[model samples]
Target: ARPRVGYFYTGKTGSEIITEKLMKYKVETFQSMPIVVKEDDSAYDAISAMFLSDVGTLFAVDQDNNLVGVVSRKDLLRASIGNQGLQDIPVHIIMTRMPNVAVCYPDELLVEAANRLIDKQIDSLPVIERSNETGAKVVGRITKTTITKAFVELARNELM
Candidate 1:
């Protein structure tokens, strides 16, 4: 706001404003529908699903829709090129299983999720709802591309 003949200070720098907005972002705000494959599905099937859905990662799920593992494009490429048949090898065999997979929740801060993605050196993370008895349910996915888009949007926003 402007005064009759002077300007006022909000006490926040442009970088601070960007940080404030970025920190307020939640996983649910930018997460997209997740692509998934059954734990029993073959590596061949996973490759097909990944290509068909245009996703870099695929969540591995059980019959109850509980997250069992995560599969990356690199995992498939490495497993698929082996002499052994991909169709005969289950995705679970090539996936990063529970206790090793990185995940986020709908209410989690987007920055936290992005940090996990970078720290874990992964392209994507499953957004899940956890239940001690039922296991984590894969509800969405957050990718590096999505985080970059969010930052780009913030930079383009009217902040001055």
Candidate 2:
């Protein structure tokens, strides 16, 4: 016997369907590899890493690979355009330090992370994982692009 296909929809609005899909989706499912830089690294190196990785943000990690700060392309550009010796400056000087950064854990919902990105006016969130030895280690990164990709995928799935 064949199964039914179109019985699920009763009176759901488009917004409702999208919201339900987002709520069920986890951030970890869509997060991508994070580009990391050392806090003491030169700003030039940090910018180079960003360009090489084709990412707009970079997580500054400690020796233990624990997240310490976040640096954005805007941060680097702002620092670079004004000073002649900007390249010599360290990333820690320009990065948004820990405790000030908005982060999301891997187990959290992607919608929550998306809200954080919108509310905080940021482009990315460092996906952290609590560790006994390293405190909060950056396991991955979720960006606006990631969120958009997820939404597109959800829309495609719904259409199909």
Clashes of each: 0, 0
| Residue 96 local lDDT, model 1 | 98
lDDT of 2 by residue, 1-160 (tens): 4446865545778898777766787877889998999999999999889889999999998888788999999999988886657668999999999999999989999889999999999999999985577467888999999988877877678522
TM-scores for every candidate against the unseen true structure: 0.89, 0.86
How much RMSD separates candidate 1 from the native structure? Answer: 3.4
- Model 2 error, position 125 (Å): 0.3
lDDT of 2 at 150: 76
**Mind sharing the TM-score for model 2?**
0.86
Whole-structure CA lDDT of model 2 = 0.88
Clashes (candidate 1) = 0
Model 1: weakest 10-residue lDDT segment is 1-10
Report the C-alpha lDDT of model 1 over 62-144, residue by residue, as the tens digit: 99888999999999999978999999999999999998999999999999999999999999999997556668888899999
